[model samples]
Target: MKFAALLRSAALVTAVALIPATTATMAQVDGRAGPEFAKLFAVFQRVKASYVEPVEDDVLIRGAIDGMLAALDPHSAYLDGGDLQRLETMIDGNYSGLGLSVVMEDGAVKVVSPFKGSPADKAGIKAGDFITHLDGTLIYGGSLDDAVAQMRGPSGTSIKLTIFRPGRDEPVEVDVTRGVIELEPVTHELGAGNIGVITVNEFSADVGADVFSAWQDIKKEAAGRVAGLVLDLRNNPGGSLDESVALADLFLTDGRIVSQRGRARGETMLYDAETVYRGDMAEGVPLVVLINAGSASASEIVAGALQDHRRALIMGERSFGKGSVQSLLPLGPDAALKLTTARYFTPSGKSVQEGGIKPDIAVPQISDPDFALRQKYQTRESDLRGHLINELGIKDEEMESDSIADPRFQLTSAQLEEQGVKDFQLHYAMETLRRTTKSTVALRPAKR
Candidate 1:
């Protein structure tokens, strides 16, 4: 399950939607731009001669490259050495760590969502928890990579995390044992009533193939009586663009899955059903794709496609809006540039830029005790500094709606816990499927 690491960062939808290295032939350098180059050269010379201590040329050059990319966007960065190695590991789908998707919010390490069944998840590390320390050392305002490096250890080793939850006055400590996190990209389980739950954790290499295989196994386990399907893309950061399209194609017999547009011809392309795989794999099964703020790039692509085509009922919170595509350009044998090259659109031509994929139904996770607290501190792509603005110019107030007035969802966490409902969103989706007959599910409803 190797995801294409065409990102400074998240499998939260890193990687180009499609791999197209479109190199434009540059015209002769413009004379008007000479002054800027001269200024940069002068600055370099000044740093080399006047800095407190002399710095290596390679060090300065690398720093300069990073500075340039950082100015562009949060996703763009210069990758080399350890950074490149981490990207490879993410793409290759194996690592030793606490299995958490985290982001830096104003220098604090905030949890995006612990990987499902990962060590961090088992330790009760919920999304929106602010990690203030690792192994007793205060990490506030520290490098995220350094904290991550500290957390990732040989299997069986343990790390202590000090988390500051939003509603709590004090921080809590949790011990997590690192394991050989073999990215189980596609995992399936047959629940009561013969319902199939397929969780796509990452969009790594051959994800489409992996999911198809999972469905085959799921059907077999269900004794060929699959009543419904829950495609859990919750907390799943995105990976490869092609894999996302392929996964969406599994449920779509016809129509466009996703499209990418950019300045280059190669980047502007449309992907449709059967282009990756022929026909819908689970033709008649009712599908409820679950998403949240953690469900990003690649995840959004699949969810958006199925949703726009009325192939699946999208359930859960709005997706982590990361519709921009990144291209991996090799700087040398060991280094590369993860540059934002294009923006993606759903079948209806909706850009996932700032405002992400809004679920057909916004299912809140009321079952979790910390749900209310986490909701207050949750961060999405729009929360990131210098994020790309949506062309539609959506307003912040337009993004969130009031769920408080809804009487049907007034149940407290205590009540849900007592009733043995650990996941309200999933439970609601399952209940919805239980009510929908196979006949109605087979006939794809007219797109709203």
Candidate 2:
């Protein structure tokens, strides 16, 4: 018999003899399944019967798959077979959907940020917007998976969203038509004094090659007269690790890029720079990396490595604290698991989990009048430690900041504001680059 037929027979036999209800469902859906499907069903049955509590079969099945995949490493994930096909499309940086990056925050699905040029951004879906309803149905308490499923649909379909913006007393309504969201990975502009401004959206599969190409293009366009390079990693929620390391290698001549430590693993695994690929760019070219709360994962690795080694000056808000590494494991033919396998540390041996990489100079994004007060306080190590202590009842001594410093890192908030540099962090970095000497710049006190 064919593989599909064998799977169907096995599923029918197991379901009829063991879990009638689950078996019935599997058999009905097993018409096109293969041997792998039968094996998965068998594992699901064993888990349902053996699990401590009377768990829902679906939950048990999903949990088992998740546990299975999480063991490999972080980043690999199992998408539902149908979603899997769509995922392949997404990796290509084009997908038809309502454009919004979302996450489960405080038990509610919140909008992280809307992509530039996306329908959501055009509709004014700013970061910190709380999504309360989808299609006029209350979805605040729903799972993120369910929320995403509801928000995504075929192209040209209209969906109404009720959002709570910070300043507004009442929730605002937005009607957005789903369209193809194409991510422009690298965008460049010629800034003042022939400086090059390059913005990296995300380190997708082709990001390494794309960045190398962009760098060449920038050099060619500027003809070796480029004064400075601003690499904007703001709001870039990371992608491929290989891309991150490869991109870092482009800038550094030598040094450890990043390291990973796992719970059961004996020791941390280190990734060091093997080769320097600067292309046609000159050595000692002044570079500045702009990061923000949205920079994470692979983005953090690059920024942290560069900052640790003093290869580039880092400026902007603190990055998103996502230092844990995840690995995806294939559970069955149709299901997969994405699990946190290890925690990543920068070359300086700092754990970025909960505590993110602090910028050499901090610069806050100006928020709308409504959000000003809420985001007034800078997210500092002490503040994060206090939060952890209060919420988790952990001792203050348990929290620690990673040790990484550059003698030239001197720009602070008060000093920047006092100097009348509204975006002082970036200004300081630019000025420091202009000077181009290995000397520290003293921060002037804020003017009263």
Candidate 3:
């Protein structure tokens, strides 16, 4: 249940405070004197005496700290008060309202993403949409915390969001009723052809144990035996690092699952299969994992580990490409700094920083009626400002597929709707597993 705070760009939640602090020191301690220090002090004195309005010392100091961290990376931040509470809510996995992860960008309130099965997502509010109005009142240039507060209310209440999508011609208004979104970190169901479909909503507490229990239930529900498994990680902004490693260990009986390399000696570590669970839970069963732009951090760890070992065939779109690790350094009792500590790499030494895990089979969500519109507005880690560059220097064009039309998947949205295939990615993966033999499920280069 211990989670290293990994945030979604759209829906930002955090937990980077639990790891052991590497270097404990004062936030503004007396250190080696630098000539720039004098300049900073002079500027502060001038602002205090000559400014038209008086500014409090606490406000100025906090602003200085935030500004310093903000320049480092998008993921590195100094969080306190409401921001700290937001991080806790991510770990708790329960909240009321639109279920949207949002941030302030250029004085505009932009949606990060709607949590899977949340009211915002159910109402079709895609990531990268700009919110200009709330209840028909203009809310531009407002604080992100204020915007998030306005969006929350008692369950059953309704809120209107005026969204302007990037590719759309005009702003669209959506009315969504607030609901208690108690995100069950994991959920599963038995599908046709004795396939067990496990959807990991988040990498929160006890993920490995929950997934193991889910596997047991899946086997019990099967008529004869479990035939295939589909690990659906779509829209799952990652959570606990330990849980992610432990979850990957469940399916990987041998070999290194992941490794972390950082400047500090404490941050450098390697994790293997038996480092967590005892053995592979599924053994010989065919496996397929589904990921998209929302699957990031710890989720990518699981996908990359399974894919490299040929334990599971990764499907769907590319992940969010967030391989950097965040360590929470305590500034004081109430506040802390979430610092980007290290970059993680797969067993094959592939760093998923700007380059996320590429699926073995590139599959798009062709069944959704809004598939085209959603694709036009997709968001990922590479899109976030101040993101660290990958050492390999992979280009953006190479990280994605063209999503071209294939004769094998010629079914249109309308045609698939008539055939009762609501999720084309899942449908096609299940069909592929039902038809193909185990030997054919081995790793194959993606057709990009």
Candidate 4:
């Protein structure tokens, strides 16, 4: 589907919640700042005159812009040319590559998560695994853009990935053939006991509407009243903010969904229930939201809002904790600035910045043999360089709780596999829903 038709706004795009851009009025130049500008110009002139190799002005200027944004935060970036094109492709187009969401940390490319069913995922390239080399060439300390460019190619091509997994003695090598990544943002299934399972792979355009339709389909498939619903947001790195709010609105009848606050007056905004959809679509059904370390910005927003309103029983690991909102400001015809304009808060006025949304029940993914080790080295918003600190000043100890093993969860990967439970977390959630009453699961039923 076309992005414009999906979002109902042609201009808006989704990369951790894209919003409309307002004109930025240049601030009056301060007399004290004049010396800094002069210093910058002086350095530029020296580089132009004394550099060993001739460098284009565009290269130097673009580098300067990149440096400026890099200093701000990990999410803020200057997008142009290939970068812009890639962003568009990621949001709406099919591309040939080992589908992965990655971030550069300390000169190493860290896998955020492999897109479900993509080449990377199929090859067992997991989140928190570091890609140290492509084929035989070392990729450490290289530009992320360059590494990404190298990864993408014509479909049916093969590439070698050397991965460094934490807690492993030796590096692992995997060969994967690049294929077209056609992501299904939302997928649904009607499980046992008339329970519905809706997995939101990403918060792409029309995700909320897609989810609503999925629920309707689930109800029809059950051929009876829906017993429970599990909204799976595991490994979902988040996208459109509007969709997050809209998705939350699906199960909510009234009260606030989320609020964003920015330095600029126009940047701050509030979203409430009943704004996107009228009454709750999933009325009287028990709800559970599944989140994990990979569930970020938009995912956290939905989890937090539902948790705050007592609409759903949040289960699984802590979120990625990206509370900031990125707005795509047009720089020119082909270039744009993806700037972090505002910080979002849950309905309870809590900012999920460095400290992500804490799930009501922290269920470990014991189904994976590497679960414990991967969780040990997992990166979150707090781990990123130049990440915005939570205003509430979260303690380091608060973040450490995710690692503490609970006595209740002692199932091993072998044990789960023997029982045909490939996903222990999802299995646990579905089991919980099967046994729990609606009143116990959700404090407030969605208005009919």
Estimated TM-score for each candidate: 0.91, 0.70, 0.90, 0.93
Better of 1 and 2 by TM-score: 1
Which one wins on lDDT? 4
Return the clash pairs for model 4, or none: 17-241
Ranking by lDDT: 4, 1, 3, 2
What TM-score, to 2 decimals, does candidate 4 have? Answer: 0.93
List per-prediction Cα lDDT, in the order shown: 0.82, 0.62, 0.80, 0.84
Ranking by TM-score: 4, 1, 3, 2
Q: Residue 312's C-alpha lDDT in candidate 2?
A: 73
Off by over 4 Å in 3: 1-17, 21-33, 400-404, 442-448
Q: Give the per-residue lDDT of model 1 (tens digit) for 1-448.
A: 1223443323224754323233552125789999998988899999999999989999888778877887888898876766776666666657888888776678898887787789998999988889998889999987777877888889999989999999899989998999878777888888888888999988877788999999999889986578899999998888878789889999988888888887765668788988988988888788999999889999999999988888889999998899898877765456666788888899999998889999888888888877777788788889888888898898988888675666767899899989988889988988888777755532375454
Mind giving the per-residue lDDT tens digits that candidate 3 earns over 3-103?
Answer: 23423221122213245434532234556656678877888899999999999998888878878888888888877777776776776657788888777
The weakest ten consecutive residues by lDDT in model 2 span 10-19
Tens-digit per-residue lDDT, 259-311, candidate 4 = 98988757778999999999889888888999999998889989998998889
lDDT score for residue 212 of model 4:
92
Candidate 1 has what TM-score?
0.91
Off by over 4 Å in 1: 1-13, 17-22, 25-31, 438-448
